[model samples]
Target: MVFFFLSGKFDQLQHAEPLSAIKTAFNQYFFNISKSDDERINTTRSSILETAGDCIRVLTACFPGLEKIIGSHCTNPTKVGPKETQHRFEYAFRSMVKAIATPSNPVVLFLDDLHWADAYSLHLLTVLATDAYSLHLLTVLATDREIKNFLFIGCLR
Candidate 1:
């Protein structure tokens, strides 16, 4: 399997290259392979929360009102019940749909800590990735674990 690892501090994502890389991937999938089943996944851990926050800020600037919607629920990163996390992610996914539907420009949703994410978060991510083309969305995920479990296992199956 092909795996990409994003390590180090969260602030590093503020640098243009990482964000640009994400944008490039979105463009590639959206424009070049409209009908093809190409899947792009991002994996990160809790260490990059600040970076993920920065990425979301950039996305908000691109798509106004998105920050308010997603920022409200994505506030704290504590461990929570599966149902609660799923609800939060559903809210987040709705925000993403709004942003994508309203704007001419593309939007990227960066999930920065897959390794630490709860089951609901992972389930939402899986749903998003599986339906990315229909939704017109780009998801960037980050994780630290080598062995795939939980969400990763679901992704495999």
Candidate 2:
């Protein structure tokens, strides 16, 4: 049996490599997988914080593998190409999500603050939601009601 434990109570036998600037930059504002331990400890109860922190750790594990794709921007620092950069980020983002998913374990991913999500995040959400329809994954979304023009707020008008 393959078990993917996303619990902080359990020590990770696998060690993750340090994050690159590109990977950290993307996750910083959107999902905050780079949130500090103090931040998590203060925001929630010990139990929840531990589990949440573990979730972040699990997600960020992919950053090490994605270093090449992300670090490419530095290698080509002369050109103006946010489009190509964003596409790579989106691909990396999805790959990170895939690392956390397990068909038998039924993992639930919660995405917060969608009301102000960047283009890459919104695109990734769309991709995940579509793929989730035929998989064991589940997504719980949160959005502020103030965003009257929010794409999912069609009836609020």
TM-score of each: 0.36, 0.41
TM-score for candidate 2, residues paired by index: 0.41
Candidate 1 lDDT over residue span 16-92, tens digit each: 23323333333343332233333321111121133344234334443343332333344344567887654544554
| Candidate 1, residue 152: lDDT | 49
List the candidate 1 regions with Cα displacement exceeding 4 Å. 1-103, 132-135, 146-151
What clash count does candidate 1 reach?
A: 7
Worst window of 10 by summed lDDT in candidate 2: 6-15
- Tell me the whole-model lDDT of each prediction, alpha carbons only: 0.41, 0.39
